[model samples]
Target chain A: MASKEKVAIIGSGLIGQSWAMIFVSAGYRVQMYDNQPEKVITAIKSIVDQLNNLESKKLLRGNLSASEQAALISGATTMSEVLQDVFWVQECVFEDVALKQKVFKHIDSMLKCDPILCSSTSFIPPSQFMGHIRHRSSALVNHPVNPPYFAPLTELVPSPWTKPEIVSRAKAILTEVGQKPIVVKKEVPGFIINRIQDAIFAEAYRLIEDDVVSVEDLDAVMSEGLGMRYAFTGPWETAHLNANGMTEYFEKYAQGIFDVQSTFKPVKKMEGPTAEKIIEAMNKKVPMETLNERRKWRDEMMIKLSQIKKSSQ
Target chain B: MASKEKVAIIGSGLIGQSWAMIFVSAGYRVQMYDNQPEKVITAIKSIVDQLNNLESKKLLRGNLSASEQAALISGATTMSEVLQDVFWVQECVFEDVALKQKVFKHIDSMLKCDPILCSSTSFIPPSQFMGHIRHRSSALVNHPVNPPYFAPLTELVPSPWTKPEIVSRAKAILTEVGQKPIVVKKEVPGFIINRIQDAIFAEAYRLIEDDVVSVEDLDAVMSEGLGMRYAFTGPWETAHLNANGMTEYFEKYAQGIFDVQSTFKPVKKMEGPTAEKIIEAMNKKVPMETLNERRKWRDEMMIKLSQIKKSSQ
Candidate 1:
């Protein structure tokens, strides 16, 4: 039998741990490293517990048993130890560009092989930090949604200097690990998901500011109406399904959509009284103390939704 | 037992039929009217078949049996028959100002009781057509999401002349029928849902136009990632959970969010090459010939998702 390939996970935080679990689920050896050895050990323990929980709930990804996947993940005290003989290196450190740049430069210096260097930064573009790296051709941004175990959409964004095969390799690896990877052809701030998200949030904030709707009701318009369909379809498919097809949908409602789009207020800083109002309203529903509990509920919901989607497909 | 309140459903189209099923499920007597008597009769049969299908799948809305709900709906040949002694009049007519005005005037001439006159126009504001009605104070817009039986969200938008109690009454009735109602404090074009939806769609279009992402991948970003969390929580709750609270969320992300929002291009006409490209991409995934089949699949997925959500809640 052939030996399994290896992947390196740097900075053993939540995202790093998730990447480790995902890679191991696909039968890859994942060596995780952190400056603080205790954090790496803790992350490995948490990953074991999470994988066990997913297994018990029958939501575990890939065909591997929990114990088999857990066995493939290990902690490394040094970056050189983790990056040795690895085909992929996922950097999951802090979101600071300077910190990331330093880490990437160090990884470039230590690596003997041209492993695919990926960062899990949600906002920072690849060009910002990868510009000075020796192996900039292999460095790219592979931004994953929070709780990648449950929501598996990763944005694979490459800098202008990054090789096309690097992006393709990253996409193949992410797909093999049971994730849906979307390629961003150009380096853009916020990439794809956050851009769409901020567009929705900005408009939502404006609605609350103008007193068109209350905070709770505004949310229901999504969770209860729009978000329900969005779980299964995108805006383009939604438009296609809502009418005869995309052409008919735009032909019928384009003017109205354009007219409403015009009414959107200029993007305002999400502060002042409106932000306070939103904070109060949101905190009232899910208090700061119970945020972790609420997040647990959300993750559980995501898992269940993923199961439902998988079964339906 | 006391008598069930009656609801007059004008225009026996798909929306009108959905309204009938919802009203009957709540034990209301529904009188459906159309200018063409055959259309009303056909709508009733379709409603019965739809109700039975929902029942067989265990996705029916209310406690009432499919037979009982079917028994409560009846066809009315004239406006007077449908309007008599009803506490609610839901106008699900064609999406035209002049046509709606004509129907409202006729409804005003026939009605004896002061029922809540609600238009199911997804786009038109109530003030556009309700301004000249005798019961203008009782008129409002109760725009429902498509396939409301499975995805039950109704937007209650009232005109300037509408009374406060009318809005409250509509809210109560909608709640009684197991629909989520979000009150639009002021009438706006496209109300709340479409405004947020267009905000998302516009940004998505820009991403495609800029060659940052493909049409298929852009949709996957939602259906796979952001939309997963959104299915269970709204933007405000999502933000609150994503951080310590909404305050911390804004404190951490406000600048980044504002920067991205400012980068958003002005909303342009969604025509020309972009529309054609989207049309081609969407049709490739879901052909026009198979649209109805795809719609059925979407509806089924919605039912499954709703069930999952209800069970989890």
Candidate 2:
């Protein structure tokens, strides 16, 4: 049998480790590279530990055993060694455009094969950094939501110059590795997920600013209300289900919806007394010291939710 | 044992039926009234069947047996019969200002006791209909999300005339019955939940209109990505966890968030070709003929999700 294909993971941060795990679980050999050799070493150990933990809980991805998947992930200190013989490169670097551009330029000159190059940026569009890359056609943004293993949505955003086939190849590989990939037709700032998220944030800020609701109650609006259905359906699908169909939904609610939309206050910077109030409330609910514990709880919940979603499917 | 406190449900539609089930599950005797008596009779039978179904799935809300809860619900054809000696009146009438006004006016004159009056209007504020009622001070809006039994978020919106004690009483009762309640301090169109929902809908519409993403892909962005975390945490809490804390999150992403928010096009009416495209895409995904099946599937997923949430807690 042919040896398993290879994928390179740059920047051995939390996201990079997650990508390594996702690829390795699907039987792909992952070479995780970080500028600091010690960080890469630490990331590999953490990845292995997490895989085993997930296995003990019966939440490990793919059909591979935890040992098998862990065996496929290895760390490299050198960029050349990491990129060698790889079919895909997942760059999980910092969110700065200039830093990303510099990395892309460096990787561009070293690449021997025309492997698909994907950036895990949540905000910056590919066009900003992919402009000077030698294999620009192979470049695009494959931004994943944080903790991509549990939350599988990845946005495949192609630059204007990126080849269409590259996006298709990346999408197929991502799907094969257990991801839900959505193609953003244009290189919009914030891509799709953050755009929608920021919209929620902006409105949430306005609601809090106007003193219409408290911070805790505002969050409850989503977690207890809209977020429940959203876990299974999208906004449009939700509207479709709420009424007879999409057509009838708009016919009945378009006016009321439009009227309410018009009432939204202009977006403002999230600072001042409102910010202080929110920080105080959030600290009270999930103290800064317990942030790590709360995050773990969140990840566990996501894992359970993903299992529920899979079984339902 | 003392007699169960009586609560009146003034509509026999889906929302009313859900309210009845919720009240009955908590050991409150429910008197369901409708202008059309046949609808009320049918609603009671449907509610009974639903309770049994939920019981068989181990997803029933309260400690009471399904039979006991079902036994507590009965139909009333007259306004006086439903309102007599009741401590709470949940008015789940049609979302018409004039009609709600007429219903409130009619009930106002007939009420011998000053029961806390709540309108289940998702859009209209209480002030719109409670303006002329004699019991205006007791009136407020208690809007529940669709399929309220499964999705437990309700917005308690008070009009200018509503008494502070009434809001407190309503909040306590809703919490006791296992529903999440958020108070809207001021009356605004769409209150809290719908306003947030409309913000999402507006942004989603803009994305589709600009051809940035398709209907199906846009939905996946939520169902697969942000929605996962949202099911367990609210927007502010999510931001807090995403970074070191709320302060750090703002320091990192507030500018980027503001940039994206500023780029959002002004909200427009949901009409024209974009609507047609969405309608076609949704119809293909969930055919009009299978909408009921799809809705059942959504509700089942919500039930399972709620269980996951409960277990995690």
Candidate 3:
């Protein structure tokens, strides 16, 4: 009756399609636009396929049936059509800063009313493009991990000029669509997830570079060891549960922990022989020729894991 | 038919009990000894309860039933009895360097042969205690995570004097019992897992202490974001799959990554108000009073995740 609270999704790429599905699955009316009109039809087909796949696996989010949700996603013929009465626009263009700047400028000129402008860039900060825009106060980055349906975290990062209320609204919208949104308070490079990821990767590279452990065994140290706990609990909760409490944990292992932390080497530039060796080993396990198959396996496992996490909670 | 391999489990606490269950579940005759005999009986009861729980969940690792495995674990009247005819000994005394040294010294004197002597310590390096022992060549640390049944990673850390062959054999034995063993090539403090854990924890502490994110959101960045991928793929494989390969990943994001890593603050000591804030927040989610309940929930989720991981593979 309230016209389903329209959302405009620009760029019809993988991320754009995912945003559309998420909005529609939550009963929002979604209008998708692509610079090239033909691509929108292809995106719709892929979205349908993905929705059906999730439905078959019973992993579809929200209460809407696959066809019903798919029916809610429609392509817009013009930027004006896409922005028509929509409360938000999700930009999912290529990660290059110049192209993103141009697209945001265009969107700013076309919009009739102020709408929440969210970018799906994982690297480029909002400050680069949003500072000169009329709707700069509403622009922020909603960086999602790949395959948003399975891994539901969206890192909500706001430009310095962005309104605080818009950040809260974005998180609430993501929550309605069954996404877990975390805020990055200041504009930090890599935001929260990738910054942590780079930290782990730097250490992992050093271990392999030093030949302390082979690449395979090094992987097991995480997938089989630390990952088991981290998959459910974060580092803080882990410390709490590992001992009586945080204070007890520090009392027991603080000095030893410090000693180990000091042993970590400086960040190695990821290149040359070490990178080649890692790539070769990874290819042996998941050959470059069939990388997609391995990714399929990874996604299937992630879906199953997501289900387990939800039920357990 | 070959005889069941015997393993001596000294100090029947939680870690010791887990080691016993794992050994007996693999059809090994497990001889368990504790400083106080009454504690062994209590441990056997808890072990029985754990095995039954695993069995009911259909998550039991080996062919043996809960009772069948429980029947294979017996209390030793003395250290000599526990060491008699045992091919290996897992020392699980309190996590004190001196206490562990004392226990290893007693086991060394009573052993029938130069058995593979491993300590179940999460922190203390084997080099500290094993250096002065008579049978130091066979001594190492076989660190198991808490509730070893669900999280089966065992870090095999060898002292300078530890025999290379013994390390290999220790790995083989752990593998036989369905435990994933990673060899720490050198005796490093905290070994591989804890070192990486400390790195992540240090970053997490800084992020929380700096007010970049709330304690809850920081944990969400891990459990909901990076953790979903890390659960199955390690950092290496993740980078490989993220791009065409590891080389491409580095080519694109290495500079950006280095910039972010350089921004991370020095490790904050886990004391004072920051520690208290984290503890209070954690307690609110999983009350310290019902810590065990939260732990049980964690274990159940882990078991389910393990099953999914195995089947997906």
Over A1-313, each residue of candidate 2 has an lDDT whose tens digit, in order, gives 2338899998989899999999988899999998888999989999999999999998899888999999898887789998898899999988899999999998888888878999998888788999888899999999888778889999999999999988888888899899999999997878899999989998999989989999999999999999999999999999999999999998999988999999888999888899999999999999999999999888888988899889877
The residue-level lDDT of candidate 2 at B304 comes to 88
Q: Write the per-residue lDDT of candidate 1 for residues B1-313, one digit (tens) a residue.
A: 2338999999998889889988888899999999999999899999999999989988787788899889898988888889989999999989999999999999998889999999998888888899998999999999998877768899999999999999998999899888999999998878998899999988998999888899999999889988888888888888888777899999999999999999999998899998889999998999889999988888988888888878877
Model 3, B1-313: lDDT tens per residue?
2338789999988889889988888899998999999998898888888889889988777887888888888899899898988888999999899998888888888887768999998888888898888999999999987768788888899998998999999999899888999988976667788888888887888877878788999888778877888888888888888888766887887788878887777666677888788878987877777777777888888888888988765
The model with the greatest lDDT is: 2
lDDT of 3 by residue, A205-274 (tens): 8888887777888888778877878888888777778787666787887777878887888887777898
Model 2 misplaced regions, further than 4 Å: A1-3, B1-3
lDDT of 2 by residue, B24-133 (tens): 88999999999999999899999999999989988888889999898898888799999999999999988888999999999999999989999999888787789898
Candidates ranked, most accurate by lDDT first: 2, 1, 3
Q: What's model 3's lDDT at A90?
A: 94
Candidate 2: give the clashing pairs: none
Question: DockQ: which candidate is best?
Answer: 2
Query: Chain A vs. true chain A, TM-score per candidate?
Result: 0.97, 0.98, 0.96
By DockQ, the better pick of 1 and 2 is 2
TM-score of each: 0.98, 0.98, 0.96
All DockQ scores: 0.84, 0.86, 0.70
Candidates 1 and 2 compared by TM-score, better number: 2
The candidates' interface RMSDs, in order, read: 0.9, 0.7, 1.3
